[model samples]
Target: MRDRFTPLLAAWLRLLEPACVRCRLPADSGLCPACVDALRAFPLPAAAADDPAPVRAGLCWSPACAPLLRRYKFHGDLAAGAALARLVLPELRQAARPELLIPVPLHPARLRRRGHDQALELARLWGRELGLPVAAEALRRVFDSRPQTRLSAAQRRRNLQGAFVARAGLPSSIALVDDVLSTGSTVRAAAAALRTAGVDGIQVWVLARAPGRPTARLGSGHEQVLHEHATEQSGTHRLIGFEGTKAVGGMA
Candidate 1:
């Protein structure tokens, strides 16, 4: 197989070479040097909510991190997922050898339409790189709801209510993987489901947070919007998904 495919793979690489895997900015060997530092610099634990459960991330949801995730999630860019996974592996390690690395599951309809699960792709790459077991099926999405992107904060919470279920519970410590966390309602809902299944320690791992949205330092204009919406709510956990059962509303 290697002999037969090597030439074709070589041709593809030669044809597609030198595009920065993240921003496609003249690849300086996979990721540019600036992206290298961006990927590795800063302490992720410091940025998370000061809960006992340690949560870590790769980059703040800034302009630097958006392009890559958009490319991978919306444009079907699988390589970007692997590249981003390499960026987040260090933080994943901080969670300490979790019994299972689970990617947030998508509904079957969306998964089929998208032709991929971006989080699952990242989790698989992460598990491979770190030699940890990736449980793509550990948690199942019971609700086939609308995309959280379009819903308001309240609707997001209600939409996701009882949306997840765990088939086989694992250790107290479990790492959940997602591409981006805007309001964190999704992760918290998923975590709540996991908690119901008996897992105690849950840490979320994401590629980016809403820039300057309290949880992370991404430099998007949305930060002001997030801050404004956040003031209305009171709690350590910020609402990433829309609140209220109403279909349309404001976001944080």
Candidate 2:
């Protein structure tokens, strides 16, 4: 019977799998302990005291974490995506639960080129772990928009104004999943469309959050900085000191 041979099949497959892509270690998990530990060292703050956006991330985006996501996103690497999903599972367990999972939809053109939607891939992984439904086709991108990475927050908002359209009725609450949050324009637009269709509560869940909000103008305030510290310097942005001490004044 297939059940009788399941364990044997698993063992045989493990033997043929490649080493951890990041460390070249013999790991069937797609990542070794060392790389995972390095990622944990930079997990995002559990919760920002004054942040109102219901966004949550496992790690802050960094040069080290970039390759893992880029490989999964651009190079069509499934192993990298699963490893990153495993890293995010713990944080999702610690957060408030949601009724359903919805991935930010991709334009059909982009979807054809990539061959898969990265957000949908991540949503499926998390949904399996949490016993939630993944509504991959519940919302659709109505039109293609410019890449958001280079745009200011305001510009991003404008670009996505009508990018997403709901394909069906939404539930009262759902978690919107994505691989990363930069200016957050895409998620915001998706949420707005969902809300207009009667979904009242929305939670934005992502694997990572890129550092800084869309940059502000010259001589402007340091709103882009996630951390605020009052140190012995005039124009430097430092994270809150260890244990969140090194007291700084004013709000971020």
What lDDT does each candidate get?
Answer: 0.65, 0.68
Per-candidate TM equals 0.72, 0.74
- Candidate 1 overall Cα lDDT vs. reference? 0.65
Count backbone overlaps in model 1. Answer: 18
The number of the candidate with the highest TM-score is 2
Worst 10 residues of 1 by lDDT: 242-251
Query: What clash pairs does model 2 have?
Result: none
Please identify model 1 stretches exceeding 4 Å from their true place: 1-18, 23-29, 37-53, 212-252
Q: C-alpha displacement of 224 in model 2, angstroms? A: 20
Report the C-alpha lDDT of model 1 over 69-116, residue by residue, as the tens digit: 665665455655556766666766776677778899988766665556
Per-residue lDDT of model 2, residues 147-227, tens digit only:
654566789789889888876577888999988776677888998888877887788889887655523321123222211
lDDT of model 2 at position 184: 70
